[model samples]
Target: MLQAIRDTHRYSPGELRTALRFLAPLGLLIGIFVLLPVLGTLAGSLYLDTTFLERRFAWFDNYCGLLTDHTFLQSAWFTLTFAAVSVPLELALGLALALLMNSQVRPLGLLRACVLIPWAIPGAISARTWELIYNYNYGLANALLGGLGIVGEPVNWLGTGAGAFAALVLTDVWRTTPFVAIILLTGLQAIPVELYQQAQVDQAGALGRLRRITLPLLRPIIIVALLFRTIDAVRVFDIIYILTRGGPGGSTTSLSLYAYRNFLGGDFGYGSAASALLFVVALGLSLVYIKMARKLKIKMR
Candidate 1:
């Protein structure tokens, strides 16, 4: 009882007031910027607010249509598939890059900054650049492939379902891998060097040290990176819009894009429904990711 009392922290009334004051601005901002918009969208989803038509209450009809809409289903599947594939690849590549950065590489500052360039580039600009690279005639990708004898002809990257999928995956991985690497690198730097030194003294080889020391320590950060990347992938929109515009029979249409299309077509009620559903999915996945991470952390500890 004595130890528990010492371990507990109790805030005084002054501290409670100060803390509340400090948090008030953040609470207000969230209310205005996040909660209000979300609530508005949810309320709007229940009504038919189309142009040149009387506003009518929808009452979940839009959601029922989404359940049976072939386009919506296809887009949802594609979005899930994109996230499933891209998130894992990003994790793997990010892990490799983080390991490299963690090593004693020269010019570390410059190299770290260079690694961030891809991520810093605007999505629309990068997408446009990639569009050119995927061009059928004289594009850089095909030129290299042909020069290296990898293929006889230029591949139509955004012209087919499979090709477009692969293109988007590669683009997303390239663009976002650096973000994961940076996060993982922070975790790597936090690990005590003494741990590695001790492992080495115990006759642990490089692989043994990495497996026993590095990976276990880095697991939490990896899961966090996974959560972020998966969420970004699930809501991927601007890149798809700029790169392929959900081309090749809408094979790459993400749920976001699907909803955007409805909004563009003036189906406000339906679009709001789609947006609400996507928000729910992202929220659910984030909760699951956090819970799983917590469970793993507890198990490991």
Candidate 2:
């Protein structure tokens, strides 16, 4: 029996060689594609001015400088505030849309297609379109507001700090809410219709049904939607960049925007450190979301 087991455990040289040959390419590809870039970013963050190669090892100076910088701190605060406001709004709007679409409605297909249109457009293009819409001279927003006697002046939406921040949030919410709605719609569709019918038979009203049935079933999807929105909002750059360039007074300058500015200013070490910090923030958020997901799983079971 021992001899038979030993024979089974032993691999022939030819088989071992074939297995190594197959795995070697995969390992090499991973090293080149994945491992190298992460290592390079870390190395760059640690590097300082070097006459020999334009940069040299500077240890934690970049990170320390970033932590002490007022602009970086303000940018971080702005990013958190943006994400905090936008994420909940997206989830709420998305959930409402999903619920509305789930009901028997007129022209449902057409409505869904229209709802997804904003999400289909390129973010940059949408930002530019919104910029025009918010223009001080001929923008539709000021025209509508003026028509309603909401304001005497054609408000310069992109020409002020608060206006620019509001514009960024509105544009981002419009562009990304469809994504959350789609995710929630999938969750809603998976829910058994019988559950709703049962609730009706129990004489549960809309609020009760939503609280007792819909929300419980939709927890996972809600968590996932929040995760996606939070990460995206924290890293927001393109829309704000295109719309206001984090402008008017740096009101909308986020962490990612700061990183880009640093990189453009040729502060590679600082930029890399900011990027690494952003990565850490994103990773921490993902872990928290995953933990919440696990808790939901336990509750469900």
Task: List candidate 1 segments past 4 Å from native.
Answer: 1-10
Off by over 4 Å in 2: 1-35, 49-54
Q: Kindly state the number of residue pairs that clash in model 1.
A: 0
- Quote each prediction's TM-score: 0.93, 0.87
Could you say which candidate leads in TM-score? 1
Q: What is the lDDT of residue 282 in candidate 1?
A: 91
lDDT score of residue 279 within candidate 2: 80
lDDT of 1 by residue, 135-166 (tens): 88968899889899999977876788999999
Write the residue-wise lDDT of candidate 2 on 42-77 in tens digits.
888998743334677889999999899998988898
lDDT for 144 (candidate 1):
89
Record all residue pairs in model 1 with backbone atoms less than 3 Å apart, i.e. clashing.
none
Worst-scoring 10-residue span by lDDT in model 1: 1-10
Q: Which residue pairs in candidate 2 collide?
A: none
